[model samples]
Target: MGIELLDRTALVLFSGGQDSTTTLAWALDRYDHVETVGFDYGQRHAVELEVRSVVADGIRRSFPDWGDRLGEDHMVDLQVLGRISETSLTKGMAIAMADDGLPNTFVPGRNLIFLTFAAAVAYRRGIRHIVTGVCETDYSGYPDCRDDTIKAMQLALNLGMDTRFVLHTPLMWIDKAETWALAKLLGGDELVDVVRTQTHTCYEGDREHIHDWGHGCGACPACELRATGYRGYLARQQA
Candidate 1:
């Protein structure tokens, strides 16, 4: 990355989840001005939307250095996406595998649509760099979260919008464990605590039970991945 890129403002596709929170911290560390964009797509885990402000406020309070770089936040109403998406994420159906072998929790074209909207916002805000946390290693077979999908979206966004917009996925190759480690690396224990207590990742949107890793239903795929990753992160820390 060039110094010019670092100096330019960045718009982060922040969903108030662990991955996006960490990515937000990553952007704050690199960019001089960092803005955030979240989508209210009517996901079953809508609670994540509620925590977005809390997480941002937590970061601002705990990391004053990075807080100075934090800029505006944009919340795009994408309820239409929920109306069209029949997946478990948008619906109240039980999480299961579809006949095509992919999990029902996979929201088709979610990241693609999200990137498109983020690009539009970035264009209006004069931001050239767009950061996201979509990863393939721990993506749970979500096609939209794949590295290839993100690259293609970046190309399409730039071509369709007639502007140069670079989509940055810092967690593209890292697993959940590495993601946890990245948060610690970016903002130390403070960032980790914010992510653990403030961010939401459970597919079922369960916040009642607080686990060692965080709050979740503890049985959902998301909660399982988060818990398992935290254990691995802890083990590595001990070593």
Candidate 2:
């Protein structure tokens, strides 16, 4: 691996999913010190924080001497900050369990709130880069995950905080297949194994029915996106 991304400190919005996991590994490769921030905004997968903690601690064991270098992986609880909404990811909402209607999973302003908090944390810690895993392609139609939204947040963060902070969506335009390829390209097989085996990506949170690569009911929007990526990946390998 050429590993161009190394030796700088970046604050990654790590979500304990494939995309964010890839971004975390990418940051680790590029930055000397890599810190991660996770928002616990009453999402269904808030339990994934436990997942992130395990991953972060494993990273620590790998580099025992670099306590400060790894930075902190924050799991900020935003339940009170979240208002009652229709999105399945928010408080006081009935999740459809499947992407049958409007995805009921659309937490409006989710990415916005996350980025806002992340930007604040980064500025306080004097970190400038905020890495997210929002990919416009092969997603479940989250408006906040779009490229325009991310750019707008970047501008707002700079203007609001009076600092030149950069919002880096490393997986912005890439499809799920491309994201998986990135894991292999940047993080190597070992990190890829870690990511595939861990990281929650299911609305149902059914880890038992999942393979090492994907999860959930296998019919929901998240499952569909993941399945699409899985097929694409297999096709690539076979091709």
Candidate 3:
């Protein structure tokens, strides 16, 4: 199922990657005030937060018609949550198949914690909409990226906080290729270039190596998926 766009002030859960960058543009297109909230959960790809800042700045500059709707960017430190988790993302362990059939990179409840914290921050800023770039179709075996999980979290947040906040997932039903298409549609070809070069998705967080999709450690699962999707997108465009 697809999510409907919200026409209100929003808080984007910006991760400084292709997906989140696309969603930031999506939110900016629909909302008047689009603030961003990032997390420092001790993930191996912490550099993506820095990329988030650059991309956010680029968005404000590129989309001047949106005015100063790009509000403050808030970064939360959730290092304690990462310290207790043994996921490859936070711990930098080898990527292996978990006994439960999930990827080793699956950070348990990472999105749940991120959305909960983001909602708290958004509520403080009087925002009721939270936009996230999570995509179930392109996700790397992370259950938290699923739509049902997001709905459940949204309901819980509303009940707990007594606020009617809507969680926006622009990429929830789309794959990485479609996400690329969305970036183009929302912010034109320039936004696509920004997402391609500035975003970071490597589980190993290797920014030195350039690939077709972006900069990433080619061997990692994230890079492999991104490369495959970019290839697909190219083929479709050519056809």
Candidate 4:
């Protein structure tokens, strides 16, 4: 657990979703102080902040010793800066989440912007290690989530700030099944409870189906991925 030495401090890019919630648990174990950052880009499902606040609050309650390590309002008024090629997340376009191929849900430069800002935040705090829940294996054609992109960004951020920084993505190679497995490893069955109840992955900004793990729509691309991963995890357990 060489990575566990990161216990003193780290920053997390949280979106109150399965990936981010899993990242939070992972952060709690490894980092002595984990600071979570979430962005509000006026997304289609902006209700995520409500869920995010709940999750952060829970973290403070559960890890009272590490109280207030979570930071709020890492978000920007992205609506003004959100202009890009037609995207479901950037625009209110009713684009279907990609199923067979890359979906419109992929907002260009989103992860780039978020990570850069997160790095800036870490820099201000004199922290170099930053943890995020970005996954490439399970990624649905989001160009920003690639390993090469991450490395490049790391270089750019470090050079721009003239400081040492390590962008850590624990779920990069792992699929969602593995992510669920990791969450369970960190938080046990509580993983399911928090992921399903606290995380927000809905394109529709829903909370009605909070009990359905991270799956939002049965037909949407995001929902399909979550369902597939969850089922794969269950199958593994059964086997």
Whose TM-score is greatest here?
Answer: 1
What is the clash count of model 1?
0
lDDT score of residue 177 within candidate 3: 81
lDDT of each: 0.91, 0.73, 0.85, 0.75
Report clash pairs, candidate 1. none
Q: Where does model 3 exceed 4 Å of error? A: 1-7
Query: After superposing candidate 2, which stretches have Cα over 4 Å from the reference?
Result: 1-7, 58-69, 91-102
Work out candidate 2's RMSD over C-alphas: 5.2
Model 1 lDDT per residue over 43-128, tens place: 99999999999999999999998999999999999999999999999998999999999999988888888998998888888888
Quality of model 1 by C-alpha lDDT: 0.91
Mark the regions of model 1 whose C-alpha exceeds 4 Å error after superposition: 1-7
What tens digits encode model 3's per-residue C-alpha lDDT throughout 58-171?
776777865477888898999998899998888857988899999988888889999999988877888879999888888777899999999999999988888788898989
Write model 4 residue lDDT over 1-239, tens digit each, in one string.
11122337888888888888888778777776677787877687787777887877766665565455554336545564456546787687786756646778877788998898898778766666888888789877888999999999999987887777888999999999898888778867766666866777767775666335553655556666787888888888789
Model 4 lDDT, full chain set: 0.75
Which regions of candidate 4 are displaced past 4 Å?
Answer: 1-7, 61-73, 97-101
Q: Per-residue alpha-carbon lDDT of model 2 for 192-233, expressed as tens digits?
A: 666666776776566667664655667666767776786787
Candidate 2 residue pairs that clash:
5-29, 5-30, 6-30, 7-31, 7-32, 8-31, 8-32
